[model samples]
Target: MITDIRLRSQQLVNPAFNDPKELVAWMGALQGQEYSMAKWAVGLRLKKPDIRKVEAALEKGEILRTHVLRPTWHLVVAEDIRWMLKLSVRRVKLAYDSYWKNHGISEELHIKSLDVIVRALEGNRYLTRQEIGEELSRAGVIVGDDLVGYFLGRAEVDSIICNGVDKGNKRTYALLDERVPPMKELHKEEALAKLAIKYFRSHSPASLQDFIWWSGLSITEAKQAVGLIDAELIKERIGETDWLIHHSCARNVRAKRVIHLLPSYDEYLISYKDRSMALAPEYYRKAFNTFGIFYPVILHNGKIVGNWNKSAKQKQFGVESSFFIPGIEVDEGELDKAKERFRVFNKGGND
Candidate 1:
């Protein structure tokens, strides 16, 4: 079970990267539904984790956030964006079909919007969502509040626009081609194989169902992709359930009684259809809710024993937790270390 924890969360051998881009590249994509938490998700995997540095990487175009895989924001490396889109764009488009229909986002509108957005963001300029909406309206496309977001989200999924540097505190969009250098696109088979391998390597001891849920690939496609990477993956039968893990993952490491302040929508929790391995069924409601909200979790030795929240203002950080597994003794020192980690992340420094 402990081996399950280390490998599934990419902690095998405990390697740490200095660059957020490298981490995103290796992990394939980090869920970006909660943007700030997504930054910390990548930060926690790096040696010197800091929110500001991850934001710097985003500004430098080392990594890009866009609507990719599963019709949500995912932080993907610039070099892989083209091939990733080639792999998942059709699926994402299909997922949004109903919204497109209800909002009258016809093919013509998509095409026209693309042209308008391209012209508006030409010369490597960035534009906020509101600015883009106004530009669309000026072009005779009345994008109401709801449609405005749908338009931008559709545009992003279509690979026309991507995250630009933050203008003040508001996020801006840039032409994907301008922000990301072109990379040779991979053939569908090769792309599927590569994505499967990356996912298995980073988030293994997971089932094909988990891959389907995380990648938004159909079960048939998931099986095909997994088949392509069979040589690199090892299968284990834990109880009645079968799991796939990377061949190189260490299986001998003992799970220490450690604590981790996993951020909201952490990949450790979100990258699977089944979370029973990491979360106890009895405490599920406290950490996860019906509204698709995943709160910050308190992980004690790879299992979610509770949920935690932090309040940070200026340089001060305060953390509070509610434990589900009552009477479980967590050393006070361990709690302090967890609080300090959150402090460093919140303060954006060791201080």
Candidate 2:
């Protein structure tokens, strides 16, 4: 039942937005550690999925890829990045501090490195991590490959820089102030309420614990956030658990047989802390590996029935599916249509 609601809430059943930027804004932030696959994550939720359109939005800074929500990369719209950073950066900094300390990067050195990075990108120039590291090295700061990412992530959470257009296959960073236009800022409580609403609205039937994990907030803070918007949420007792769904989210939608080829790290699976509603414990290993990798999953009527992968040979592209359950009933015609949609999304470009 929750998964059925999620199909509509996540825009997978009836995708409402044609523009990727608006869609990213609606979902709050999408996990984007896997760059190209993450674009497919966005494409999977569009009314008219287009990989090139997502790339264009990223290139134009309509949406940004940076370290936020946790210590990983997430795609957030330009309008919400400032407030979202302010809301989550403290926890993220705490998560990253150990890496800085172990690498002998002191507060003073970190500040100096950020200054060098800012100066290097001052003239509207987007520089790759290696180029930024070279700038730091030229300025007499010793920055190695292992420590470069931590330093750049530091700048990103500090609101100094964000993702720029990619150079071929390499990623670059630009000054945040330049890339994002100024917008009205929300205070701490307002931002928290806004984020909580967005999470519950798009990812409903989740628990307070789920919010705590996704927002990276302490239990006390998480409770306070839920309290702030308690009136706007619906509390339901399902089995042994108490679930929270946004009051505005559609409920009790009739279930139908549907098949979706969800990309790895898509929000539908990653946004919640407890995945039992969709991912069965028996087949967990089949969809997720020991290395913390979530593979592309096959969703059939609100449950993960199988997993899928992409393959490329010369100029041709294809998808391979593996059903975990033996002799599971799947419409070949629907599966073919799903694969064709993915192939069309990848038609003009490699990504």
> Which prediction has the highest lDDT against the true structure?
2
On TM-score, the leading prediction is: 2
Model 2: residues with Cα > 4 Å off, grouped in runs: 348-351
Question: Worst ten-residue run, lDDT, model 2?
Answer: 342-351
Clashing pairs in 1: none
State residue 241's C-alpha deviation in candidate 2, in Å. 1.2
Q: Please provide, for model 2 over 1-351, each residue's C-alpha lDDT reduced to its tens digit, 9 standing for 90 to 100.
A: 898888887888888898999999989899998998889888888887788899999999998999998788899999999999998889889888976676667899888888999999997899999999899899999878877888899899999999998999999999999898888999888988988988998888899988988888888878988999999999999998799999878898855777889988888887888888988888888877778788899988888899888865565678989899878899999988888888878763353
- Mind giving the per-residue lDDT tens digits that candidate 1 earns over 125-243? 99999999999999999878777777788778888889998999898999988888778878888989989988988887788888999888878888999999889988888887788
Model 2 error, position 160 (Å): 0.7
Clashes of 2: 0
lDDT of the candidates, in the order given: 0.81, 0.88
